[model samples]
Target chain A: MPALIEAKNVTKIFGGGLLDKSRTVALKDFSFQIDSDNPSVTSIVGESGSGKTTLARMLLGLAAPTEGEVLYNGKNLEKLGGSDRRQFLRDVQVIFQDPFEVYNPFYRIDHVLETPIKNFKLADTEKGRRDLMIESLEAVGIRPEEILGRFPHELSGGQRQRIMVARALLLRPKLIIADEPVSMVDASLRATILGSLLRLNREFGISLIYITHDLTTAFQVSEDIMVLYRGSLAEAGDVDQVVRHPEHPYTRLLVGSIPLPDPDLPWEGERAIGRPAGELGVQGDEYCQFHDRCPYAMPMCVQTHPPLFHTHPNRVTSCYLYRESPELPMPQMTSIFKSSNREGPPEETEQLDALDAELEVSQENSSTPTSADD
Target chain B: MVEETLSAEEPTAAELKETLKVEDLHVYFHTAAGAVKAVNGVSFSLKSGERFGLVGESGSGKSTIALSLLRLIKPPGKIEGGHVFLNGTDLVTLTEEQMRRKRLDEIALVAQGAMNSLNPVRRIRDQFILAYKDHDIDVKRSGLEERIGDLLTRVGLNREVANMFPHELSGGMKQRVCIALAISLSPSVIIADEPTSALDVVVQWQVMDTLRSVQEDLGASVILIGHDMGLMAQFVDRLGVMYAGKLVEIATVRDMFGDPLHPYGQMLIASLPSLESRKARLEGIPGITPSLLNPPSGCPFHTRCPKVMDHCSSVTPILQEVRPDHWVACHLYEEA
Candidate 1:
């Protein structure tokens, strides 16, 4: 059987019109597949401008990719017609980031739950539709009587978001793409929302694409994880392996930056503030996107961008350090490594030294204890 | 009147000279429905050069307390029956002109969203200049420019950033600029209300790092208001857990995380997803935060408190010293 949804080397570029000179490559050559036979949770982790949202938009067929194609059930998403389009829409669903803005202020909250059932013809009578709504709401731990007649404003953020989850469950979609569903909710309520989503994946065999900036929640819910940096895949693997021992430098930085809840495990070491802004999505495919900020950056990173090299049986990282992996296709560009060693040129070394000196000065100026060990 | 309870700690005279002290703060908004008690009898103190954290869910009145400190509460929202003593001076009793001088010069606020805080049409330098002029700083144009450059550099931004507009800067850069402006006068206290909420995690860490460094250099007390428990655990020396506009618990960072006194605090800590280990299910605190307009008769959290006693709904618990440094206002501790 074919995958539920698949993207084949998709590339999305925004704003390269005749008048507009700057072209932003929102998403690079990305490919992934969710199998229909085996339902699993895959998390797409990235920063704000890292194109996580753009990928979600493309997968939902809301935006067309500039190059390559997005396929639902092995058919091009853009080309689906009649029954195929309707089936695709029914199977695939989305939960947006902000629950406050999703609802229509004029309508009662019941309208949100009733519309999906009416449009899909899941229930013939009003009573059948009401029963379906009540079941879905109770599945997510929400009392139907308390939430049925209330307006969107009457409910708390957590309640509104849980209702959205119930709305998604009304259709029993095969796949749910939740983009930062709990980011707006309270810290204590986050677990409640995520717990229900995890239930959807387990009790019901639904695949999930959990897109968020938070690694902790992603690790809790996702089986597989993909780390994106500036529209490029940094690392992808089993959630445990990738989070515990990150291969790519970008992934390492992201893992290090997470403020763990345990006060005993305070953040140690002088965390290098990663690169300045304004250079996002501007670099071409010629050079690695993370070269400027990467601590393990070498001349090879500047010379050519690295492809996803299989590091382990379950892991793939787009870093030159893993280029020696047996699964990597060694072809035309082997000559580039011969031109430069790890220590490339005197000028490049000097530039790195200058950056080091700047960091040192800022560290010294602070005069606080640099590490927790002290 | 709450000052008497603070004396129960039995500190030295030197220790009593706190940089900022709030006692019996009750701020309410008289809306059409009724009087919405946003902040009810909340009290805390900040020592010089200390980092104190105020954490709660949205509408728990953490931001309202911050605004009350600066006397920024407007007409509809009244700071009803409270005394905000900043350096031995009660700020609530001060005139508008006196409060204006205290703001940015003595106590500064780094607002929630940095995107809208800065002036869109003006350069960063011009904004800094305007602040200096409003405060009536006697300095030459070149000296002001040099001071602005120094402030920007302290927050890890280049001096060239002063020449650019707010739109040209990224979210992190805008936050850094806001930090720079807040610390321009070397205020004794800085209230950063969710300064990094809009930025990504990486940028959030970076911006927080900058804020910490600048704060250390100035030896200023910081009232960090945010709902992220992980951030509070790492950054703050003391933590205050607010519920339904009241401070349900207050303790040192180590004590609060290791052993939270209140039921709500414990649930909050348990609910946080950890990188160290993954649990089968997180124990989220059941029941919604109570509506402050018509709050619960006695204990604000009794509606959701798992360990609540019969008297919890009929009798209010006063915040008192349960341990040496730990303070809690719950019936469970009251019996002890």
Candidate 2:
């Protein structure tokens, strides 16, 4: 089956020279495919500095991958001509995280909608343009009457974002790259944005590649999930399966860190392990990017990087926790305190109780303003 | 200290907040778009030593309320109406110099975005020392560095790091330094505006924990301004939802999230992704937050409200106590 979007060994390396190693690696040797034949939403979830945005940028053609290929229908995106690129643009529209960025501010609300129409050449006459604008606005659940003459400042953040979504609908694109689309919209108004995106994917069969640091919102709109950490794939699989039972320690910690909306539920116990920032890829070329932070990290992990092995039928993980290869050793403990299973210390329960009461306020709630805040 | 048991049965949030009543507060800005009614007749009460959250999307008059409390709204912006009473003291009536003395000593603010809140060039210790001096905290210059270090350690940061510039520390640490400075004065009320927005999830937890513990240590009431329901739910005891330039709903976090009444409040809670209910599709409130300049005549949320009525377009709803201790301003609740 021809995938709607496909990336093979895509690496986005931003730096000066080979030995310099001054640049940050945004996406490292990432490969994934989403089939157009069965269009479904895929979520790319990662915390800050996790190359999720970098991957989205490379896939959207805003920037090219440093190492591998980003192909649409098996065609090289970088090689596409201006017209073909236009067609690609028409097919793959984007709903940006910040709605303010999409608007020129100088132009009226109608102008923002009208310009997209003119650029795509979707309408021929003034009446046709008006009709097209109305249809696009209506398609995204926005009334043309209220939004047509309004200025960007005249509308709310949620409404402005709807206008952004409406602009994307102007083209009826097959693949919509929504990079934290709902992050800027208000919580009360966030659902409408998610609903609109869902409608686009379900009703119009538009395949969406949703990028977000928030697992809950990402899971709300997407079916498949890809976990990225420090520019490398951590876990990729069915959204429900991966989210419900996260394989990688990083994913587990991420899910664990998510703050529940309920005020009473505090994640005080079993604190998530912090990222040891200074511990950059120690074992030369073959080591998991998340090895520094993994609570269950084994010594063998330092020498050999785990491949993205197909563990669960629909899921894949790049962690040695599932590695049973004969070549790989039953790794002895790297850190003495690896798991809770081996604990035999006295007064451990008392220590755990004290740790349990400290409100884990930041773990799950500390999300970079996705689509909700400026 | 206005001593009222935090667990008292009859201690209503309004009654508690009434010790500091902001009556018919109106903050306006003369922008090119005409008079931007940034805070229009915005009135909410905060009793001494009770955490009250003023929540709304950006431009919803949340930040304005905080600035208005401190008389910090700069030129082009003016407090056109209303009174703000903190501990029965009318803050609006106080002179600039009078307020300056009372600023950190009484009314303190933790500004939005931790990065911008701290002075980039200044050392964290110096800022603390300066803030301490501003609040008239008695401490000599010789032992100021050690005291600053002790304070940083209290907020969960290494004391030695205080010597470094603001840029060197992580977002969360800088926020803690800001918290440390804000708390250094031991102000009666601390207003933190979007304090955790810039930090990472793990760091956010630590920062919030620090805020919670610090609030506990001071026994001072906090008015948190933010967009995250999850964070506020855990941090604040009471919550207020603002729209355009008016507060739409105010209630306990438990009530707001457990059983929301207002269309906007219900929508806000429903939009969140919680662990327990993996509800297949999230129901986000449709439309956008309205602009303050010439906002909707009746209900500020009417333009985007799903259950909006005809009367909601013409008549503004006052913040009324719909439920016991739950203050909501909506036509739907006006009938109730």
Candidate 3:
């Protein structure tokens, strides 16, 4: 079976000025395909400004790519406008990262839940729509009465998120772009929301595009995974394979950085090694997108960028080391990926967390720390 | 796995202890609606160089206990009743002046949301300098800058970052700075309230490792408050399971995972999703945690607990040390 959603060499550049006039590359030479045949999930993992969100937006046809193409069922997404676009929207709904921000505090939960049912004409009569609404809520593990007349604030963070999932379920979209759906929720409830995604994928066979920063959750649900770094494909492959034996340096750093709560683990007991730098993106061609920050960057990496190369069967990575440039020595980038003050507009840490939470790839909201702080 | 029960009267003293002991701590926030009992009759002790974990759902009052420890619980939240003792001295009896002198020197806190804990306008180093001044750490100007740099380095950051404002760094770095601040005075106990809960997987990894090594090196007992059970399992020595406003279980990290006595703890462990088991559909805890204001008749967990007996709904169970070290406040384990 062919890929359900394919972004062939899709690239996007957002300039402060008009499209062609400015010189900022938000996404560069991005390429991947999500198979819809068996209803598997594809997780795009990266830190903030990695162009993961930009890619998601583009995939949903919310934003157009600067170069290459995104096709849905072999049909170009950018060209789909009007009722066709509406159908595309109906088939591919997004479960936003922050459920609190997604809804209005003043509006009752019914308003957000009912909008899609009414807009899509999912139900003919009042009783039908009401039953459909309750079923959707029940499917997402929320009771009809619990969500009936409550405001977003009246619900717990996790409850609000379940409501978001229920609202998306009401549409019964084939593909869901859930960006960091569980990041803001409490720890205990996160697994359930994640479980809902798994349940949806298995039972309903809904193809899921789970954007997250957490690798463990990605490991739990995704069949195939793509690791994004600074708007470039760091690595992509099978979930179990890539996660257990990461091919790329970036993926390795990400897996190594996930801190578990148990203290006996070897990974948790190691001393921290924090190297430092500023502003992650590359302005000039000199630095590898990961240069200055990658633990395994070469001097050559700073002067030239690496192209994505086939390594393990299904995996691909863009690093000079993979090319076996024996003549060049690896100069580590100050860090790998850490949740830093780098992405947000907030001067305080609270706002930084809010910003970190935007939309994590698939279901993981991973971060970049100076991997050097090993 | 049954446990041995010990009464509160038996002082935990056989071992040379400079531990902070909290007894029947009840904290209530006078919200607009009513007096919200945030930390209702909670008790725990931190031994020297021991790492303790406070695990709970939202509104379980873990953070409230942390805030109450430092007297940082803001307006509306009053320490209604409880005795908090640090080392041998009771902090509840101390005046504001004494607490000010003792805070950073004896007990430092790395609060949740790293950046908010840091001052945005002031240079990140100034936050350290201010701490030094506040705690009366006597060192010359030249020596102070180096100390600040060293502190940054200790927390795994560049000394150069000391010159940068909080905004210039990333979330992980800012959190490291918070840990750096918590360690500046070399306190006996460092309370990290939800340190890794805010960061991404990568940053969370970096932050957790940084904290683990830092706590080990300093030999200070740590009180880690987190909602992530996976993280709690990996990072803590002992775990406290809180429900509503009460601590229902306290056990070693291994015991908590291996033999969870409380119904809440068992449900939490059973519900957790792991990388190893993809097919395991988590048994979600049946009902929502009860409202703290008007909690259940007896046990806070009885509403959602699967093993609730008839007597449980009427009689409040006092915290009994069911094992040598593990404590539980459940009637099901009454004879354990």
Largest lDDT belongs to which candidate?
1
Task: Considering chain A alone, report the TM-score of candidate 3 relative to the true chain A.
Answer: 0.78
Q: What TM-score, over all chains together, does every model reach? A: 0.90, 0.83, 0.85
TM-score of 2: 0.83
By summed lDDT, the worst window of 10 consecutive residues in model 1 chain B runs over: B3-12
**Ranking of predictions according to lDDT:** 1, 3, 2
- Where model 2 places Cα greater than 4 Å from the true spot, the runs are A81-86, A106-130, A149-155, A268-281, A324-374, B1-24, B30-36, B47-49, B135-140, B277-281, B287-323, B329-336
* Model 3 agreement with the true structure over A151-270: per-residue lDDT tens digits: 666677777787888888888778889998988777666766776666666557677888988787787667678788888777776677788888677777777666543445445222
TM-score of 1: 0.90
DockQ of each candidate's interface versus the true one?
Answer: 0.32, 0.25, 0.25
Interface RMSD of each: 18.8, 12.8, 13.6
CAPRI category for model 3? acceptable
**Which residue pairs clash within candidate 1?**
none
Candidate 2: tens digits of C-alpha lDDT, residues B184-274: 7788888998888776666777777888788889878889998888878878888988877777787888999898888888867766776
TM-score of chain A of 2: 0.82
Q: Look at candidate 1 and tell me the lDDT of residue A272.
A: 58
